[model samples]
Target: MFTHRIDSATYLKLLEVQDSEKLFQLIDSSREHLRNWLPWVDKNTTVEDSRQFIQHTLDQFAAGNGFNAGIWYQGALAGVIGFHKIDWQNSTTSIGYWLGEDYTGNGIMQKAVSKCLDYAFLELRLNRVEIRSAIGNVRSRRIPEKLGFTLEGTIRQAEKLVYGYVNHNVYGMLLEEWEAKENSSTYDDETYE
Candidate 1:
């Protein structure tokens, strides 16, 4: 089921078939806002599409490759965050995330990401994690930066959105660095609950 509570009002839950309608509604309402950065927004036009997406994430979890989860805030589905895929050989993975327009500016994504990092390092014992953001997506870039990831570099035209190709700014954090930061900071105990 994979639920991690971030606070009294927010948590991350693994998407399920029953969540399809809510997920689709949120995406439909946030279409214009999300379309700017998310390439699959246009393709996800129905509850069926969302169901298929959730099924795929469930399969990913089962395969032990990675996972995608819905960001539930104040009892509503606000967005999604997940590891694109894990490179077990290299002990590395890249995260991808997005928030609905109404859910921004509350530090929700940052907290969710921190919890995922805890899971990656302490639970999974992964060595490194990365987050790649479109160059112009300031909000997305801010999450990893606030969490103390180092700016690795930019990959030119790394992804193709509906409009065109976009450059991606890569941010990376090593497990050692995360451990040091956690030791020095006031991190909470709400991980993998």
Candidate 2:
């Protein structure tokens, strides 16, 4: 696994044991901010639960199912972003992420997502990636949009939140599309200058 360091912040491949403490910190720090979007936080799950979760993620990574990268900002654990429910046969994957409340709106998540997407498309050879945001989650929805993902559609009551089932807006981006955008942007910049 590759450990990526950007702007002095490292994105390390998560370990089951060594990473558990940081995972707990992330959970505790984001509890209030996450409660509205993620129901799992409402359970008030323990650090042991995070250990189990880390174990599951590591197992999945080992089995070639998916990969989760821990985001460290300024040498402290800040959040996590991952490719889950990976379908290699279908050339597709889903991207999920969360950040500590304090790190919100600082472009850290954007950088993390960009790095993960590069890994997925270039290293893993994935064709497409998807991001689903709960309806009305402006901040969450903006991630995919900022990355040039196309809004595919909305799934009504697609996810069950703490309150109840809620609609989700599905966004998708293809590797080819990303590459084209990358190339075009370079040309556009040259032309503008």
Candidate 3:
């Protein structure tokens, strides 16, 4: 039930049964927006497929494995952001996110990511979070960079893309580093915009 609203246009929250309707709507609208970047999203994916996907995500959250939040813009569904492959033993997690095409370039995703990272480090008490983006995905790479994440390295042929397997640039941020930035007098919250 945790929820956050930003700028009267965007929202982030834990998914619920009531969200299924909105979730379906978002998927239908997002198929074309995401079809290029996310290989998993197809124009033909059914509502049932999206439901099962959301159900799996919720189940993972309930099992203490991870968390996923729906992103809503201007009271309409946008996309999603989530933490996955969390290793509690190591206090680490990976961030995954996508924005509906219409909502891109408006700084909404940047703000949403800032809030998610804040929650992950300050509230969830995670030590490190990693973000990996396909080598050519400049937009995706920009999120971690804007959030002050360090560019760790590139994993050659790390993941398969729509075209084929490609190298991934890995980036990471540590809790200590985030805390230092947050506590710094020069740090500007407005930068997230």
Candidate 4:
């Protein structure tokens, strides 16, 4: 039960084999919404597929790499947030996330991402955090931008969606910058704790 509360009404729980069914349900229901930007959506056709994903994440966690954690909103599985990879030598990591259509517009991801950034910097001692969203994805891109990340530039055709390839807008935040933001009172660690 890898659980971390983001706030009074939200949390992130590690998805495991037992969670495959519920995870599948969420993905199945959000297929159309996710398929637009996520190419792997169609590949997740069954509970077993989700189980494998959970197992992989668990392995990643055990290896001290990074993890894919499920977002819970109001006690329900809402979506996922994960570090795609953690480059230990470089002390850097990249993150990705999504929320169900029904759970959007509640600032759920903003808070969730803040906590993850805190963990990356404080616990993992990562030097930088990167977030990349498909071009034109205003909602996804806004998360990093609002959090004070610098837009590094666009990677043309960085990801392949079901429909076609899409450009990605990359944003990056350094540990020093995060500390500066913390010192400036833009984000209070106590509030997240």
Find the candidate with the highest lDDT and give its number: 1
lDDT at 8 for candidate 4?
Answer: 89
**For candidate 3, lDDT tens digit of each residue in 1-102?**
668876677889877766777777776776776766687876336767667777888898888888888988887777788898679999999999988776
The model with the greater TM-score, 1 or 3, is 1
Worst 10 residues of 3 by lDDT: 184-193
Residue-wise C-alpha lDDT for candidate 2, range 71-123, written one tens digit per residue: 88887888888887799799999999888888777777766777777778888
Segments of candidate 3 deviating more than 4 angstroms: 184-193
Ranking of predictions according to lDDT = 1, 4, 3, 2
**Per-residue lDDT of candidate 1, residues 1-193 (tens digit):** 7898988999999999999999999999999999999999999988999999999999999999999999999999999999989999999999989888898877788889998999899989999999999989888888888788999999999999988999999999999999999977553343211
lDDT per model vs. reference? 0.91, 0.79, 0.80, 0.87
State which candidate has the highest TM-score: 1
Off by over 4 Å in 1: 186-193
RMSD of 1: 3.6
The TM-scores of all predictions, comma-separated, are: 0.94, 0.90, 0.89, 0.93
- Indicate the residue-level lDDT of 133 in model 4: 94
Q: Give the TM-score of candidate 1.
A: 0.94
Give one digit per residue, the lDDT tens place, for model 4 in 79-148.
9998988999999999999888778777888888988898899878899999999987888987898789
Residue 91 C-alpha lDDT in model 3: 94
